[model samples]
Target: MKLWEIAHSRTGDKGNISNLSLIVYNMEDFKEVKEKITAEAVKKHFKDIVKGEVIRYELPQLGAFNFVMYDALGGGVTRSLSLDKHGKSLSSFLLNMEI
Candidate 1:
């Protein structure tokens, strides 16, 4: 399923980097998410569209997961000119994601 379909997302942009905070619902959901959205999976999905790092965090107490994607805009939070990064928008790209 799409990212939004599986979890809620909060996005912030700083320069060329975009941070995505994902709050998953439960353990089952988290497992499914991890299985489908592996680091390699993200790299392939955003290969040319984003640069930098994609970090994932697990919050067992909150039953949530967070993803911090860095240098997505080619420069990072300090030098990106465009706030919207083309059709490869986070929300849209997320729709194509299985997790």
Candidate 2:
């Protein structure tokens, strides 16, 4: 199943960094997400666009994970020439990932 069915996302961006928070629909799903959604996996998933490292910050109590992606915006909103400079659509792309 796609992660979207079990999770939702919130996003923030500053300069070339994209902060994507993935919150599971239920606490029971935390283990599944934690196991499958590693920083390495995310980095591989977004490899084409992400030029820097992917860091995963765990929020176990909240059943959530926040991924900080560097060099993801092509540079930054104001500086990037890419169409989706803020990389907001990347959140939706991530939601479509299958477990």
Error of 2 at 55 (Å): 0.3
In the range 23-98, model 2's lDDT, one tens digit per residue, is 9999999999999999999999998999999999999999999999999998899999998888889899889888
Candidate 1: tens digits of C-alpha lDDT, residues 55-97: 7777766756566667677575455565664323674565467
TM-scores of the candidates are 0.70, 0.96
* Candidate 2 vs. true structure, TM-score: 0.96
In model 1, the Cα lDDT at residue 55 comes to: 78
lDDT of the structure predicted as candidate 2: 0.94
RMSD of each: 3.2, 0.7
Tell me the lDDT of model 1 at 54.
79
Among residues 3 or more apart in sequence or in different chains, the pairs in candidate 2 whose N, CA or C atoms overlap within 3 Å are none
Question: For candidate 2, what's the RMSD?
Answer: 0.7
Q: Give the backbone clash total of model 2.
A: 0
List the global CA lDDT of all models. Answer: 0.65, 0.94
